[model samples]
Target: MDARKTIVIGVANGRGAGDPACQDGPEVLRSLKFLADLEQTHAGFSWDDPIRLAPGESSTPLDAVVQIGTQLAERVCSHLRQGNFPLVVGGDHSCAIGTWPGVKRVLGDKVRLGLIWFDAHMDSHTFDSSPSKRIHGMALACLLGIGDRRLADVADAGAKLLAADVCLIGVRSFESAEAALLAKLGARIYFMDEIRRRGLREVFAEALQRVGEHTAGYGISIDLDALDPAEEPGVGSPVAGGLSLGELTEALTQAHGDEKLLALEIVEYNPYRDTHFVTARAIHDLCQSLIP
Candidate 1:
């Protein structure tokens, strides 16, 4: 019955991305010494068994993503039903297709869900629009009721989140189609340029306001690529300029213990690319900031 209890669910399948190395993200993070320290120090925080793809589900990338998303959704829904916070660490950003929908399922149809997506890319491309056709790039579009039907219908039929209730921050890389889609839908985007002008703390506060307005609850989805690649290079797709670790952690703490904040998801970690586990430590710091 303690709402402060957090269940960490690691979606260990990254088949939705062009690179599958990120699939190892969950396992690597689970073994980190800090996790054990967290377990002993915080009685409410614990890692559940990592979720993976079925043995024969590799027929297609979309199929694989859907299967993993479905499993993740069920796990998230179960944890939320128990009044625990769900912290989802992803194999790739494609986890959004599952994570948010699961939160929505727990909130029910009448409750509106909001989300603030932190990423280097817009993640708004559909199969037809994406040149690479990676589903990881299409997550937000699907959640906004725009992309492939299979993704939109994950935890339940229809959009998991509303465009009005959504905001994207730290976007500096995305194709025209995805940009056009978000523009047409009127979703708020605080591009890196704007974040630099306004500061991450200010932009994040505005984003929190935007997503929380009239919504029952909101969740934060952070793609590790949203951090500057020079500083955090262990992501599936690293961008040149992004948020700093110190600034981002400070901004996130603003929502700490905010009851309306439903869940948290951080994705796109590639252990193979990490230099000296710097990014791993960044992940630990991020989780530590928000852990109740």
Candidate 2:
């Protein structure tokens, strides 16, 4: 398989973020014409239209999120089967509820998978623990097989990731219970303070090593909010102190060269909240680095 063969899955479900504007995340990114721009400089890249709930589809918020997840799972799985890497862009963090599971589905139950989550929140909430009860906040929990069974079943095989194989970075806005859950699950969290102290290069090198050591490969999920609000202000949940655009871009560029990097997903970008397309331009640059 050609390593450059890439499939882009755009998921436009905002129910998880509880912000209707987030549903336009994909469209916002598309408006930048990143793929078209990439084709001029790179080869073997293709894109699919953003996935959306059908007209008149009836489902609760949780159910709708899960459904979109399942749809994304199918797309990711198919791309993987053909030996193509799946790059998913999302309406919210909840898109991981399906993205990671789709990777697991492609690998089957016998193989183990790992995750590297770059985000401001742990995204480990449950209905019982969530202050807002938004599905986006609970995505990582669902991926680790801790939330509702409906979400846990998104992969159809089982939980897409294991706590021992997962790592979270730039976490500075999580609920107390969410932090506790990460501890209970044994997932590593690299808070903003540590990243600032150790620096992004060292921190990201450690993260890649930790997640890559035990598994065949790992899927990386980047929530735009993981970056400082000043740099990526258009996220669904913005945190004040976070990684800088240069730090994130440099770290990601280094990581993108890994042969064990199986899939990539970027989420929670809200164009409506952006000031003069700062977030959109950042997203465009990030995609350019990864695709080329």
Candidate 3:
């Protein structure tokens, strides 16, 4: 946040979800000129080459993810080494399998990594726990080093984030196994109900403080579904009661220019589901608010 130019990395992958249409998300946003104006407006804004799966890499979904994820990890790690902030735009939440690991590898072993995940669902499922077996639902688990070996062991051999250094906000949907896993690990989760009672501003500030504890820095990953579908329904998964744009945007501004804020990732932007580009604009504004 020290006025460092932001490097936008687009992850053009959708193999982790049931619908693979979002693999085209980064390209769609690029071609449609959604981000064209940002480059003109901010001197610090520019796009890094989008990450995509090479042909013949898809022997299996798992194989495809591992391939792209490895490439993405290298890309993100290289950017961090250059002292630019990495803003990862995603094809699906599964790109997280690479995002945090890249950040952690750069931070190294002595310092811990902290994350704030804003999503409608817990995104904490494991292959054994998930009924759908969609890897998108298991991103947080993978980031925490408890899912498939390929994902859990992304950068190092173990976890990218400790449960104590992580926080999940806007979680209204989750199954028992993932819930038990997080609960057993003692991760702090401010569910939708709690946010409703205490308010997003307060909750987000507390979450920021929670993740900031005993860590080098923290990052935020937002799933578009975390915003209420009635207000913004462009994501692949929509929840009825979720965060409002006004509140979320205002809350995000509080973190603006915070040097401790390491990286930002916003994912699950299904342009096909959008109603006249409302969600696209949401993505635009969200990034505008937080980028250093």
Candidate 4:
């Protein structure tokens, strides 16, 4: 693999700063040896400078995060148009609002973009339905053409992803109203129960097929909380009974080979809560899988 084929962007905007540990996530990954490993194992892979939140900004402030993220998105989109794969290492799930728009801008309407969201929470909440109004939970809603107008208008010339092209994977818990809204929009969803019965292979296969069917290419947005708390405890909202590290690795290995996979974003890594940097290592390994 050509080293130039991959462009990794580390976004260090700790939106859920209630736990300061997230702010150190990017550095933790670097400290744990992700950068050196990528260079040695995948010759063509390299990372861009980490994009951090503006100093003194509040994470829960939806408008502020949106502005910072939109600027970051522009940088990421530029790389994508150059045909370099973007591997976004995130501060929180809210980063997707900016990252997805960048992907859309590069692809335009020439290719339909499918979203594969891996998370325990639905992340489909609009401001009205959000209990805490944390921007992290509402990122997906913003990307899907609903939510704060400022965020909804992030894509180039004011475009957002069509709901029909989005799919939610591993969602086991969500607000009732958000669930109904997702159902109404006809979003494809594979809940935990469904995954348990069909198995990860079949479920992942179906997810890729659904995204492929609707668009020319797809973007994968993974929230670490989608993994079981026991396996990945360094997340803001740790959920029980989530996928294990091995299960997630298998799913990613398959997805990385898909021709239609255009971009990938991994978010919500809180190093403060992590046990001996296990989560950081897991993230590094996942990135390695995708590069080659």
Candidate 5:
């Protein structure tokens, strides 16, 4: 084992839900023995008492989601400073704003940070580009320093990552404007076609290499929509032709080798959309694999 303690954060803020059932995702996973199984698989792994954001209060006008996200990020940052591996379970993809700051605080100017975003959608929409203006769609842009000021400022002053340092994986669907912006920003993207041609192993290896090359460490953010809709129907955005659960597990397991990995955040699990806890179990399994 790496000797670094594993700390799981169950963020129960559900403002980003496409369906209301997502609000209960954390509790559903807990009731299904997600924590117990994780402990059984990795002796030293344990869950932190979940942090709950009040339902209506928010610190930002953009949405309550961003406010709660900031709160979550602060907690995650504190955990990393204590030498713990922070595993954030999500209410929505918007939580990445909260998650990335912790890494920024730890590495500071010493290391640039890279972001590996696994999702079916580009998640690169900005307020001007998105028709719906959903916060979830804008998260990637926020982290890359191009969205609402509140979100873009989540990281420490001058510590945010550049667009070149982010790699989008398993992106098979994207809005036209989002695609154009992504191209303009020169971000690296490995779509489903590329994954099929190169294989998951090579794809993940290349992604890690690219991100780790310039940064001291990188963040791993997986939106359940990156998985085939059949495998992860619980997500807010369900896209077809995505990675299988097995492939996702393998990629995440390999990511543990980078001692500089700051944290892992999983988002968009909607319990209302799920049938019989299928997505939750897959998420639990992935968490178990990454614990060591």
Candidate 6:
């Protein structure tokens, strides 16, 4: 097996989620020396220093989001151009506004990129559909070319990921408006109940086949909240009856070395709500599973 060269980018802006504590997530993982530990655990894997956005760029949340998104896109595109896997650790799920678009930008018009979103919430709300006006909740919608133009056009307006090419996994919480939009858009969703009925491996295999069948490659955006709060308690948005850690890790491990897995983002880690770094450790384990 060839060594996997990965680029780790960290965005410490919590303004997108309307929660400041999430900004501390990247620092928490860094402070714990997570990357060094990974290097020691796995051979043929190496990571670059995390790219982070500067603080106090703007007081207005949208402006801050755009700034971070622009910088993140540049960094991610650079890594992709260098033939490295981009592993993004976020300030919140909102960082996804930049993550996927960056991948799309690099792949350009010829490649159809599928997106697999693993989250407790649907995260498909538009500005009008969102009751909280939180960008974090509306990231998937934007990536699919549906939300505010500012966000939806972050990477390349015409290069949006198609809704049909996207799949939502482990979603257990959502508003009626978001659900209606997803149904209208004809998006594929694998709720926790369906996952349980069909079996995790079966459901994930189907999802992978669906997403990768028509696309050149796909990106995975994992919101920690997708896991049961009992298992991952440090997420900003916690919902009960989410996927178990074992199930998620197993899926990731199964998909680990697929050449079609182009990008990965793990978001919504709030150390303030955690007990004994459980969330961080879980993230570390998941990263381990992805390492080649």
**What's every prediction's RMSD, in angstroms?**
1.3, 1.5, 1.1, 2.0, 2.0, 1.6
Error of 2 at 62 (Å): 1.1
Which of candidates 4 and 5 reaches a greater lDDT? 5
Going through the candidates in order, what is the number of backbone clashes in each? 0, 0, 0, 4, 1, 0
Distance from true position, residue 200, model 6, in Å?
1.3
Better of 3 and 5 by lDDT: 3
Off by over 4 Å in 3: none
lDDT of 6 by residue, 221-282 (tens): 89999999987899988899999888889987778888888888999999899898888988
Best by lDDT: 1
Full-model lDDT for every candidate: 0.90, 0.84, 0.88, 0.78, 0.79, 0.83
Local accuracy of candidate 5 as per-residue lDDT tens digits, 1-292: 4877788888776665445455577777877775676676565677787766665564443657756767787888888888888988887777787788767877776668998999999888878888877777888877777867876777454337777888999998889988888899888999999999988889988988888898888888888899999767888878889999988887777776568677888888888888887898888877765664
Q: Write one digit per residue (lDDT tens) for candidate 1, span 255-291.
A: 8878898899999999999989999899988887776
TM-score for candidate 1, residues paired by index: 0.97
Q: Cα lDDT for residue 117, model 4?
A: 93
* Tens-digit per-residue lDDT, 97-200, candidate 3: 88889999999999999999999999999889899999899999988889899878876688898999999999998898989999998899989999999999
After TM-score superposition, what is the CA distance of residue 12 in candidate 6 from its true location, in Å? 0.5
Query: Looking at candidate 2, what is the lDDT of residue 245?
Result: 86
Best-to-worst lDDT order: 1, 3, 2, 6, 5, 4
Model 6, C-alpha of 124: deviation from truth (Å): 0.8
- Say which prediction, candidate 2 or candidate 6, comes out ahead on TM-score: 2
Candidate 3 colliding pairs: none
| Per-residue C-alpha lDDT of model 2 across residues 62-181, encoded as one tens digit per residue | 889978998998888888888787889888888898888888887777778888899989999999999899999999998888878998788584567789899999999988999999
List TM-scores for all candidates, in order: 0.97, 0.96, 0.97, 0.93, 0.93, 0.95
Pairs that clash in candidate 2: none
* CA lDDT for candidate 3: 0.88
